[model samples]
Target: MSVNSESVAKKIKELPHIFVILFCVIVLSAIATYIIPAGQYTRVMDEGIKRMVIDPTSFRYIPNTPVGPFAMFVAIELGLIEAANITFLIFAAFSCLYLMEKTGAVDASIALMVNKTKKNPKFSIGLIVVLMIILAVWGSTGTLSYEEIIAFAPIFVALSIALGYDAITGVAISVVPVGIGFASATVNPFTIGVAQTIAELPVFSGLGYRCAVLVVMTTFTIVYVMRYASMVKKDPSKSLVSGIDYSDFTIDDARMSTPFTFQRKLSMLTLFVGVCVMGYGLIFLKWYINQVAAIFMIVSVIVGIINRWSANRIANTLCEGLSKGVLAALIVGVARGILVVITQGNILDTIIHSCVGVLQHLSLHVSAIGMLVFQNLLNFLIPSGSGQAAVSMPIMTPIADLIHMNRQIAVLIFQFGDGFSNLLWPTSFMVIVCAMVRIPLSRYYRWIIPFYAICFLLQAAFILGAVAINYGPF
Candidate 1:
């Protein structure tokens, strides 16, 4: 079915277990606060409820302060902000998709690319992998924005349709490769740059090692996704929505009537150049002049008007895109609320202290493993890799030093825990992207488990080997 033909809103509602999972998390977090006494588990339960309610900004600006019951409420508020960011980006991206659809640019682009790769699917896949590798390598220079997912998603969808693949397959092909790149990032400004800077490592100091890890992780992710996609293609009945004939969603009809005008082509070209320039500014120039969304929004408007799009049409498209974003933002916002509540109850600190305390008793070798597992568990609570790094790194680094563990190894542990679970985490942006494309979380989990298991083991083994040789930045 076409995106325009169906009520996307209704589809979102019909998805099973989504709300149940969300509600359960919130309720469980609340219960945790009640069960863990404030005195016993300061990290897990914040007794100082007054601080949180009295000042919401305190939680945003000041780290390590106990907020109590107010933590739940504040978490919800911050969760809203995070949601807003996602919403804004999604809306903007969707707007571009809608316009491209209406104008036929998307179809034309896909048809052109498909014809070139029609004879060899392997070549097409290789091309995608190569591009991801290039993007990952340049990502650290501050040139890559996670927002590329937004720009390329519809293209992936269109290409999959052209290639006689399921829509979910298209989403997977586009997202998983980029995800692998992001996860195994050699240069991702957001993930690696932010993380390494926080860890006090020289900028891009470990490029060679990270690049190697990136290749390993990317290869594993690609093989698994491709295999799962091929299975789904052969057996549509395997899908949750087996009755849906996604093949009818043609890129040709969408583009046939929309002539490729000079202005339209120019606008599209400008967007391409703009994104490249934005990447350069972010990495090499160290420019943070605008959030990636803002940059795209401004460029989109300028291009829209230049292509002679009517004012009303532009406004309508913008609104539609923004509405989708708002929905995503709400989910994120609510999730963040749970985090805030847990923080306020002072349970967060208690939990951290307790975990570290347990590690204190373990032998040095065992302590490293303990730290790895502990960081992974902590990932559920703090989803952002950079945010988690800021909070956990300082504390964990000192502990590593005491045990004669390499600080670099400690950081690697943090990266592994933070990056690997992103494929599975409901709270993660990648998961949100999958939801946007109508890929069921349950199905995604099934497709991804083998890949995740393999990568996790490989990463763990790599870390242990490094520790064994005392080859570390510490």
Candidate 2:
């Protein structure tokens, strides 16, 4: 009947719902406002890079401005506002995709692919890995896409199910590769490019080593996923969501009977063209949620016309999709809420300053690992790769020099910390993927932990190597 550390800790550990865990974390962050000292750093607009960079030496303590109970609730609203672009894109993207499904285009396509797999089972597994690689490549180039990728998680889940794999396998089929690729940061303008700019290194200069890192991580992911798929195929009882009903993800009887007619082919073509356009925008135009959402709008309209769908039907279907996606959208907003609470507490900078302070006296090699560790912890506070770069890179750049470590290695540490931890953090796009796929966080963690253990080992080895070789174009 009373609150205690043990009971609270147990409750958090046992809590299966991400929503509750997130809110509990928000409450805890709200409490941290009172305990963690408030502080700030002077910021400057660097004309050289045309981006805001911090002056790490300018850190100073500020008066504590702990959030109040009423303000805590308001923070949720503020969080949703700050994250409107993302939440809006979630709705719009789902509507666009659901519109395709309603036109029978997606159904026909899925049914066709399912049939293809039936004829060549080996090719089916190969296709899934190829798809993962394509996506990872997309992420490695700095796309770091959320809406488009997360929206497709269900499709991969359906595909994985068709391939005799579980929903967990399906989610992994998409998420794991993207995480690995982003972590490698071969040519990521957002993470690597920005960090290099801050550190006065040539943009995208360490290409050869980064490419090697990408291949290693991608291979690890592919092997892990393939082995899991093989094990599940041999014994379905071993599936992570073994008892759960996946009928919803299953292709409908009517869809299988509809046949892949010429009109349906046109619809499928539209979907393909739409995806290509998205890829172009992402890679070249550097589109974010709002821009991508606009593409979805345009694509949905064209797709509706292709199928001869009634305008009213399109609207209704879009609404239906939005309704289905509310949970996922709210998860994004709620996850943002946690960050809002932390930011409001003014303790985020204080935490970063304190963490960095401990690393100053360590040896160069150890300081390299410490930078990575700080970044991993910082990922919980700031999940965005570029945003993390902007805030931490300025501080980390000087620390790397101060402790006699290579700045290139410092950037690599940040890249690994931010990208690898993306799949683990509850507040990440991966959480929305888990929610959409109905995989509880606990189960998701159990499934992903081994992959990460291997990931961390490889990352550590790479860090050691980068430090050893001076990993530089500096």
Candidate 3:
């Protein structure tokens, strides 16, 4: 093959679009039902929490209930139905953030921040660090979806560009910290909460250790991102997204020269306050998806009125935002669709049980590491952190007991496996961010691998330490 032809072939060999990947997984999961035996564990109420948990000693294989080819298509719709709440939450959150973006307040604020600190690279780095920590904390709540953050992509892209960095740096500024924070989840309701419940451990216990993990991961991500951002700013050609038509995400001269008006500041203030309030509601009010949706809607309306946007204009912007999220929402449903097939066919537990059984003979510390590996691999099939916890924790809890492993360590391993990979996995919410910013999935995978390696090492070390010290309350 000629050189040009070779380049073309290489391009063709790149990973398929996320939708295609998810669809193929859905089909394969449906087919696997026939091969993987159907089995379930009996559930019993935990005396302290009054939550039903799998009785570790009560698992038994049941008759296989394999899904047919036709049923595979049905699983897609069922997956959408199962994921409806999160889907709608994504739509609503995107719409609200879209409304704020349309007002140009957030963009203006980002531009202003960039301009004020552009002269001081360290100051600009500090800005990136602060934004990352905030986003990471929000992600740790386990309630913020990638869709909610998608609207901020353009703003950060513009900010990074203004700081003489590239679009990929902007994307990293927006997502990498959240991914790290997510991996080091302390009180994350989705992973920690669900896994603890299933494991019959006190919810959010063992957080001291998790906090330490979070600090290390967040600090490392900040350094990694700052180094890359500085390198790109020094030489734009070094940027991953160099030569891409990212002008759409860049702040033009006209936008930059424009003064940041008081109305814009207040509008930005409203956005911050809204997020703070939402965080409060999530942490204290015990809010879920619907509540998050409602809060975003309310905030959008308030910001709209503050921006003096007429009802008709606000309505149009909201619709446009919702449209932007359609791809992401569909992606969520399609990814969830694979889980639906595996779940409805009753093979999820079997898969977990079988994997855990393999770890039975390993040394306890190695078994804990094996559990982390299993959960990490399983996360590819089931990207939803809470869903994976629901499916795996029941079996893992018992395995922890059988192998003399601390249940809290098991939950910690689950948290690490379920979350750290979201940044790396193609079939995950990270794809939604990629879709929003037009970042190719493969490019993101390449950019994130080193950081992910560091995270994995940290997580393994933490898990091993947990095992050694018996990190637990149970």
Say which candidate scores most in lDDT. 2
Worst 10 residues of 1 by lDDT: 49-58
Please, what is the whole-model Cα lDDT of each candidate in the order they appear?
0.63, 0.83, 0.80
Candidate 2 lDDT, 1-474, residue by residue in tens:
556986896557543687888888889999999999999888899786677778999999989989878888888888888888889888988888888777777777777878888898787788888988887887798665565788878878887887788999998888778777888888887788888898889999888998999988888888898898899999999987776788988776676665777877887787677778777777788776678788788888888877788889877888888987898888888888878888888899899999989998899878887778899999999988888888999999888889888788888888899899888888898888988888767778888888888898899999999888889883
- Model 2 regions more than 4 Å off: 1-14
lDDT of 2 at 329: 87
- Residue-pair clashes, model 3: 0
Better of 1 and 2 by TM-score: 2
Give per-residue CA lDDT, model 1, range 1-474, as digits (tens).
776657785566454655456657766777787665443321221132111111111222222444444555566677677556655666666666566555556566666666667767676667655655565455323345345564565567667766656666676666666555666666666555555565567655666767678777766656765675567667766654445545535566535345566776777786787677777666667655245666677766777777688988877777775655554445656766667667666577567766877987888778877887888788888886656765676567677778888777777777777767766666666556555555666666666776677877887887787688775542
lDDT score at residue 236, model 2, on the 0-100 scale: 98
Provide the lDDT at 409 for model 2: 85
Give a tens-digit lDDT track for model 3, residues 170-238.
888886677777777777876787788777788888878888888888888888988988888788888
Model 1 stretches with alpha carbons more than 4 Å out: 1-17, 39-78, 119-123, 135-151, 189-200, 233-241, 245-261, 285-290
Error of 3 at 440 (Å): 0.5
RMSD of each: 6.9, 3.9, 2.5
